[model samples]
Target: MGKRGGSSTKGWAQEPIGALRVGTVGPIADFDPDSTPGFDGDRRLGEELLTERGEVLAGLQELLFANGRAGDHRSVLLVLQGMDTAGKGGIVRHVGGLLDPQGLSVKGFGKPSPEELSHDFLWRIRKALPPAGRIGIFDRSHYEDVLPVRVHSLVPQSEWEARYDIINRFEHELVDTGTTIVKCALVVSKDEQKTRLAERLDRPDKYWKYNPGDLDERAYWDDYREAYQAIFDRCDSDASPWYMIPANRKWFSRLAICELLIDALSGLDLHWPAAEFDVDAEKKRLAALPD
Candidate 1:
């Protein structure tokens, strides 16, 4: 919703310029996966910009962590959802790597365990939430209940259908309790996915990243697309809107996500907590101590 650009000469902008909030843009199908929406730079420039912003990102994260330690009740949750090979891991590594690990919580949700399935969908999600002043990341999240389950017919129609409202309410509750949610759907082109998948198979080093079952899921690509569209339609709200990230270019996606994190952290307007002890008294006490 703001101006699209690489970076500001001053500092990180309060609103990310790279990607638009879901509703402000047209249907997901119309957007180009390869296009860099708000960026005018090439890959080299994107990389440099990301490097430049890393310092700011780290400082902001420290402010957040400090506030939490000082008893602030605010935090941020970044939810990343996308097709296989859409670069979720890359975002976590490149962007998440920039911040202090102590201030960040990353959780990847695979197929639910039996124990997880026994509880309400949000139960596990609730447990994984970032504590006050930390950033929590969901590699895949509650939307999985609605997306994969709906696409594969893993649950009854009515049961999965109801989760849309359930998720909306859950997010609303999170916001009311001082959590800022940043939900990003990383969209990659099918052709690019095929290329990436093939590369994984061709490289012995990357074999561990591949699964035969990924091919099975690829057959249902269209169905999954429909499911994701439903998610954007239903769960997107003012309190926690979705950001559709075009992830065909891994470098661009990584940079855009970094910008989004900057926007989220800077928007909080956090300040360094004041020292509880009297500074002058503490200084005098330190001065009086034998070196």
Candidate 2:
């Protein structure tokens, strides 16, 4: 793995998350989607670690929500971008399951509605941003404007090409406004995606998960790869760096995301909000009214 910015090993014991950060310039094609980076543990250990970290994660999340109630502007935004069946849903279900839903906002961005198309590309995105003291998760994000739009030629070459700088400026503004952005590009092997898609067809319970259009997208795998590589090259920044997550192994991807969330929250250095009323006075009043 190549690293360009600062190390992400702060507050971690096992391995540095910095290993997963994309370098200044590289081919996304070189990263192995099946390999677990910055982690030495297997599935069993991953599950155990995830369980052990839940308490800390839960506490930090509560502190974040509490701070929000106390008028803090700090928040965290997790952006997940990947191919279909790259386990973005799994990250939401398992990793996000650790925190209180009251403080977590998960949004899935699909094809735009007619109304959305009438406005600028980021019009809908700005509406979904997580507020203060919340951990917002974007299933797919503004990067779609550059990725799919560029690959499919949905817009003119000059228009989509200009979005790179536009996105960078937009993200810088988010960071400036006390939002810590953790952008993750989940990398899944083409073969693994095929198998996962086939499994969805094999099981009746997964029928709804299958999309006929997924095959259409798969045909443009190489094109999408080039697009993603372009994103890594252009959109990566120090204030809001992109983490390339290996998603072939569902367990590892879930575990890695959980750790990343922990790191993000921990960096905030939050604490329980102080009570506005006097503690002793409140206690005395409660005692007098006890049944």
Candidate 3:
């Protein structure tokens, strides 16, 4: 799991991915969703995953720095899409703390602005796209156009269904550029969400995190589940696959996010660029002149 889960010496990849099942919580799985390193009630290598994640994150920093200096066009689009109380902001904050802010940008989307609604769904999203040699993160994204828009009948069923193909082609185009997309759906159980909401109510500082209408939305959890299943089924691809991150454990979710990012970043040919001028020789000449 070192530097992006690039090498799984512990055979983590050989084990199944558990904790969150596809078609129920997050994405479309080719094999059984019940399989993973944490399956059968065994949670081995949790700390090890954290260790690997940290290493990978360090490597990403190094790689990003090198890319910036080398002027290589590389981009990472981290789309964190999830329901309320899923720790999307928390995860983004934790991971973002690790990176150089000059090269990073994070945008959280809410109800459309008058300007945002002026264009189609992807139009507002396109404005936030990370340029080359930088990382851009979206806390909530265009996927909302599919989720809530379809969930509450904000749009026609036919209209929302048509977005699958549109979104796929859009992502395809993103890959056609140099952008690598990390699509993570953070998930917390209903009970956990309720507990978090209670904690928020009790703590004055945490009050900002809660929304009263969330109670109403919580009733439609089953509908959102179906919506996610459909989205995962239609959109998971080699160009941009989905990661069903378990948000029940914040540490693990952050670790997995870093692991996946590291995995993808390590794939590029990242090398320290050759010195433009002979700095060593220049230093020697200056020293000699001073003497």
Separate clash counts for every candidate: 0, 0, 6
The reply for model 3, stretches above 4 Å from the true place, is: 1-52, 278-291
List clashing residue pairs in candidate 3: 3-56, 4-262, 4-263, 16-35, 16-36, 17-36
**Candidate 3, 79-98: lDDT as tens digits:** 89877887898877877766
Off by over 4 Å in 1: 1-18
Give the lDDT of residue 29 in candidate 2: 84
Which of the numbered candidates is closest to the native, going by highest lDDT?
1
* Candidate order, TM-score descending: 1, 2, 3
Model 2 worst lDDT window (10 residues): 1-10
Task: Give the Cα-based TM-score of candidate 2 against the true structure.
Answer: 0.93
Q: How accurate is candidate 2 locally (lDDT)?
A: 0.85
Q: RMSD, model 1, all Cα superposed?
A: 3.4
Segments of candidate 2 deviating more than 4 angstroms: 1-14, 24-26
Query: For model 2, how does the per-residue alpha-carbon lDDT over 227-249 read when each residue is reduced to its tens digit?
Result: 99899889888789888888898
Q: After TM-score superposition, what is the CA distance of residue 168 in candidate 1 from its true location, in Å? A: 0.7
